[model samples]
Target: MGVLNVTPDSFSDGGRYTDIDAAVQHGMCLFREGAHVIDVGGESTRPGAERVDAPTEIARVVPVIRSLFAEGVPVSVDTSRAAVAEAALEAGAVVINDVSGGLADPRMASVAAAAGCPWILMHWRGHSREMQKLALYSDVVAEVRDELRERADDAIAAGVDPSRIILDPGLGFAKLPEHNWALSAHLGELTGLGFPVLFAASRKTYLGRLLAGPDGTPRPVGGREAATLATSLLAVASGAWGVRVHDVSATADALAVWRATGSPKFLGTRTEDK
Candidate 1:
């Protein structure tokens, strides 16, 4: 997966692709760069970010999705609003990547169930404004695992097929840097939830901190490409079913190399050659 944030306030790459034509072209570029899925987000979910209304989000993403769908690229709408998800699906998105795990909007699960599309349920505490305060956890992994299990149950009860659900630990949503590290180190525990896991640590603050300079200044998003690729390969080796990243070509190449090593675990790894 490759991220295409169309919002002007997203933490990374904000305002870079807000233009519809540029965003669509960027999505195609990512597709050619070997992204299996193109994830388009209209709203910025960065911590403390303000919310964008449903109509605005729909307007921002629908055209991009339509263009990508027409090009035969698999697209996923990164939204928590049921209205936006429904509109994106109708506009030709094949998946719904909800960061709220259906907590922010009651209709989201119903929308996914109705569309029968793969739904990525990310572990979330609250909306952007208040989520940072809600990051307290005795055991981040255990709490996240339990919360995700509850969400999966809710999704199934709301008519979503259990098989169509994917769980994301939400590395930086409400987590401190250490919490994000812990989650990545113990991702196998989340994968044990019996659903495919989507690891989305692309250009996240945790990676920035890990690659900080000698003066302790965090690396910028563009400078953290190597760290991101390392994390992606680690996640795949640790049993992640998919990874969300910005530099999809590099990640695809790294995974290809790891797959060629012929580990008993990665026997069937494949790469997109475009």
Candidate 2:
């Protein structure tokens, strides 16, 4: 999956693609770069980021999604608003990537059910502004897995088919660096849940912090593609269904290398198709 964040504050590459034309062009680039799906998000869910109104978010994503899908690109709506997601569905998005795990809007799960497309429910404790405060956890991996399972149960109860649901561990959403590390190391537990797992650690602050300089300055967003590629490779190797990334080409290249290096079966297949 290629991340096309159309918000002005997504923590990374926010303002870069808010323009519909630019966003469309970027989406095309991602598709050309071998992204199986292009995820378009209008609202910035970065930590501490303020929420945008539904109408504004709908306006921001609908056109870009329409244009890309019209050109035959696979697109997913990255939103937590039912109204916005509804507009995106009508505009031709094929999936809904909700960071809130349907906790933000009561109508979101029903909307996803009605749309009948793949719905990505990420483990989220709260909105970006308050998420970091909720990062506390005992046994981060098990807690995240159980939390994700609960979200999945809720979605299934709301009429979303178990088959169409994908789970994301919400790395860096409300997680500290140690928690993020634990989850990455034990991703198989999440994958072991028997649902498709999506890992989206693309250019996040944690990666930047990991590669911090001697002066304690974190690496800039542009410098994290290598780490992003490494994470994607690790996730796929560990049986993740897919990875959401900003540097689509880099990841595609790494996966291609993995495929050519005799890991073809694991690097190129999804558990969902089984």
Candidate 3:
């Protein structure tokens, strides 16, 4: 999956693709570069970012999704709102990548069930603006796994097809640097839940902190590409179903190398679901 933030305040790549034409071109470019899906998000879920109304988010993404759909691209609407997800699906999205794991909006599950598209339920505790305060976990890995299971259960109970469920260990939404690291190291725990797991650690703040300078200033977004690639490769090796990344070309090239080198696990776990 390639990250396409159509809002002006996403932590990374914000304001770069807010224009519909530019967003469409970028989506096509990412697809051409080997991204299986273009995840389009109109709202900025970066820490402390404010929420936008459903209408605003729909306006920002529908046209872009329509254009991408017209060009024969697979798109996922990265939203927590049912209305926005419904609009995007009507506009041509095939996936619902809800960061809130269907918790933010009570109607999200029904909409996803009705559309019959793949729904990615990310582990989230609260909205971005208040998430940091909720990052209190005794065992990050176990807790995240349990929480994701609950979210999945809720979705299933709400009539969403279990086969269409995908799980994401949201790296930064409500997690601290250590939590992200723990989750990254133990991603198998989440994958072990029998759901396809999406690892989206692309250009996240924890990576920046790991690459911080002597003065303790975190690395900027542009400089985190190498770290992002490393994390993505390791995630795949550790059993991630897919990775959401900012540098699609680089990630694709790295995966090619992984495949060429004859990693038995990589060879054995090719996704059976198209």
lDDT of 1 by residue, 144-245 (tens): 999999999999999999999999999888899989989988998999989999998888888888888999999988898888887788888889999999
User: Which segments of model 2 are wrong by more than 4 Å?
Assistant: 264-274
Candidate 2 lDDT trough over 10 residues, lowest sum? 261-270
Off by over 4 Å in 1: 264-274
Computed on alpha carbons, the lDDT of every model, listed in order, comes to 0.92, 0.92, 0.95
Give candidate 3's whole-model lDDT.
Answer: 0.95
Q: Model 2, 64-162: lDDT tens per residue?
A: 999999999999999999999999999999999999999999999999898889999999999988999999997999999999999999999999999
Q: Is candidate 2 or candidate 3 better by TM-score?
A: 3
Q: Best candidate per lDDT, number? A: 3
- Output the lDDT of residue 218, model 2: 99
Best by TM-score: 3
The TM-score of candidate 2 is 0.95
Per-candidate TM-scores read 0.95, 0.95, 0.96
lDDT for 131 (candidate 2)? 95
